[model samples]
Target: MIEKALQVFPKSYVYRNEELILEPRNNVYFRLVDVETEIDFKCKMFAWVSRPIAKSLNKYWAPRVLKSFNTLMDTNFTKSDMYLIYDRLGNDVNRKLTIRFIESGYDMELLKR
Candidate 1:
């Protein structure tokens, strides 16, 4: 169970008193955290897509998703701070949505699963 948990989670245990610490220190755990977070974000997107809702879906999801992400990553992101920009140069753009993390500044990839 520890192997399975450590496989998906960045830190197996975090200790605190004098200072905060994460276990399994040799794994370069931050990258593991990032991978888990990206997968989670994609899963949420998939779940939201599969949900049977006829209402304005984007309207319902933006705040809810952003709030969850903020709490997970310890970031102060407001709905107003989020931006969706279209940079495709082709006129045949049929709504291709891609998240380029650091360049785009949309750090949903840092969210904890």
Candidate 2:
């Protein structure tokens, strides 16, 4: 139940035509992604690290966060809902949600790449 985030809007809105993904791990494969390949963080994807620090949620409490999100936002999102459709975490998404990594992706960069 590790957590990874996808941008809901265009990356660097100033560059509207450029799309970017924020990946911070070595092997990040969504359960329903169906593909078995290493993700490319080059192109337009920004390696999920900054001057401060950041990282994806570990395989421990991601589900709970999602649950809390569902409860707090009145949405019905499940683990299976991840990466299974465009509405969840992909391009042309149909929602207006923004990711707030809180402590997860905040200072973990000190311990990870």
Candidate 3:
């Protein structure tokens, strides 16, 4: 299942470290920074798109999916200072989306599963 998900929506590694942190803001955005550089990358959530039928059929499902994504970030990340750009499209429909980095060298390739 994870392999198939990766094939559909590849996990883009924004940062790699022994301990990476992610913090979601009320504005629905996140900022990531290397603790050493003091420079940070800002990210914002765009849209939450799911399978058209599933989206239309269940109203609460989208939020649940998003919550799952948030949980994943919270559990996987080490610090809460970093912000995650929540792309529902990636989590829901398994579609890969672009994650713009405010700082350089932040974009990375996901580790092979």
Model 3 per-residue lDDT tens digits across residues 16-87? 432221212211222233323222111222122222212332444434434443343222221111223222
Clashing pairs in 2: 55-105
Evaluation by TM-score, superior candidate among 1 and 3: 1
User: What is the RMSD, in Å, between candidate 3 and the native fold over all Cα?
Assistant: 15.5
Candidate 2 displacement at residue 9 in angstroms:
22
Error of 1 at 80 (Å): 2.2
lDDT of 1 by residue, 59-110 (tens): 6554544454344434555643332211121111322222333234545443
- Write down the TM-score of every candidate: 0.27, 0.27, 0.22
Candidate 3 vs. true structure, TM-score: 0.22
* lDDT of candidate model 1 versus the reference: 0.32
lDDT score at residue 41, model 1, on the 0-100 scale? 39
User: Which residue pairs in candidate 3 have backbone atoms (N, alpha carbon, C) closer than 3 angstroms, thus clashing?
Assistant: 21-79, 23-82, 30-83, 31-83
Which ten-residue region of model 3 has the weakest summed lDDT?
A: 20-29
For model 1, the stretches where C-alpha displacement exceeds 4 angstroms are 1-57, 84-113
